[model samples]
Target: MPFPPKANGLFYNSLPPESIYNATPTALEQPFTPKMTVCEERQSLRKRYQFPEEPVDRYVAALSEMAPNCAFGPLENEMVRDQPIEGISSEGIRERLLSIPDFTLEKPLTASQQMEIAKKDAALFSIPDLTAAVQSTESTSFSSFRGTGDLLRPTPPCFRCGRASHLASCSNCHAKHARCRKRDKLGHFAQVCGSVKPSSQHEVVHSVSAVCFTDIRRYHIKTQC
Candidate 1:
């Protein structure tokens, strides 16, 4: 009678019950939270924090940012205080911090104090410009000798025969014992030695003396004629 009760609508029967959609969400289905908790995040940051090659002040600023998120309440100060000592990029600074009579792991300096020491050490000690120093050394080593022309005007004469040029066949060099008083050696004559005393005749002497300064030490080098 009423169109056979509308044939019991197949679409309506196929739909899920309303209660299934309204049921409470399981743990997996709940609103998402970060997998890493505050402690874990803080630990991760601590593990990764290291002294950068930049200025110590920059490192201090970066390290300070981690303090707000720290979960280790009382121990946070110690952690911050020791980070620079343990993770410093500079060995000199690390050693300086370690050498402090009052500084120890059990009784570490305050973060600010540690930072102050680090800044002072950074200012006091610097990596020497070795490349520039080396270039300077090379220049000094190869520089022309002073008063060289005045010492030996007409080119140096040979020590054996007092001539401008000496031949192997020269009898004096081979016959006489070549004694070098300046060098205290017997192989060469004193006249050809770099440290030879000036002769009364103002004879031309080929000698070079170089003075070099290194590490607050002086070195003198002499060359023979």
Candidate 2:
């Protein structure tokens, strides 16, 4: 068999050593490895040396000229006495015959034509008094609360309670993790989580101030002692 590729680590390991040793009676004897062919040796060298592939066939047109197109072509020509004439092409044949129209219409209607027909149909069914009906009377007026930013802004849920409110963080909730009820990522409820920024800076400042005040009071006590 040919030698394995370069990646196979055991290719050179299979070769038996030339050293001779006395065989023990208790030890199992190994069979001697036979000499490999020159082809196998060449194949082993290919793995170690990277050689570019060279095509075995340099020219194929010469071989093609020696052999006929088909085996039966010469045999079939024996019955024919005159030279063969070329037949008419499809374009020439179609030009000679009268064309028959296809039954189906590929395009039912153009985009503009369909749109115009739709507008006419809609107008026929539409109420003539629609404009007056949509308009507001002199006594009646419409007002929208949407214009107010504070009122229009969606209420965010409390971080602790998991309920929708105006608070930045949730309170009065017993949940272990104050994760958002909707996305489950934010510490606050989904409603307010988008708008509520954590007050970590304020809490940090308060803790620092408390620590400083306690240290000053302790120093005063130490001086009195």
Best by lDDT: 1
What is the clash count for each candidate, in the order shown? 0, 5
lDDT of candidate 2 over 99-198, digit per residue (tens): 3232111111122234445656887768668645544321122212112322444544444444554343334454325567777874445655545344
Q: How close to the true structure is residue 57 of candidate 2, measured as C-alpha lDDT?
A: 21
Task: Highest TM-score: give the candidate number.
Answer: 1
Measured against the true structure, the TM-scores of the candidates, in listed sequence, are 0.35, 0.15
Residue range 34-146, candidate 1, lDDT tens digits: 56678876776567544444655566556667766877688766666667676666666667677667554433334334665767787655646865676577556544333
Q: Candidate 1: deviation at residue 15, Å?
A: 42
Give the Å shift of residue 68 in candidate 1. 1.1
lDDT against the true structure, each candidate: 0.52, 0.37
Candidate 2 runs further than 4 Å off: 1-187, 191-225
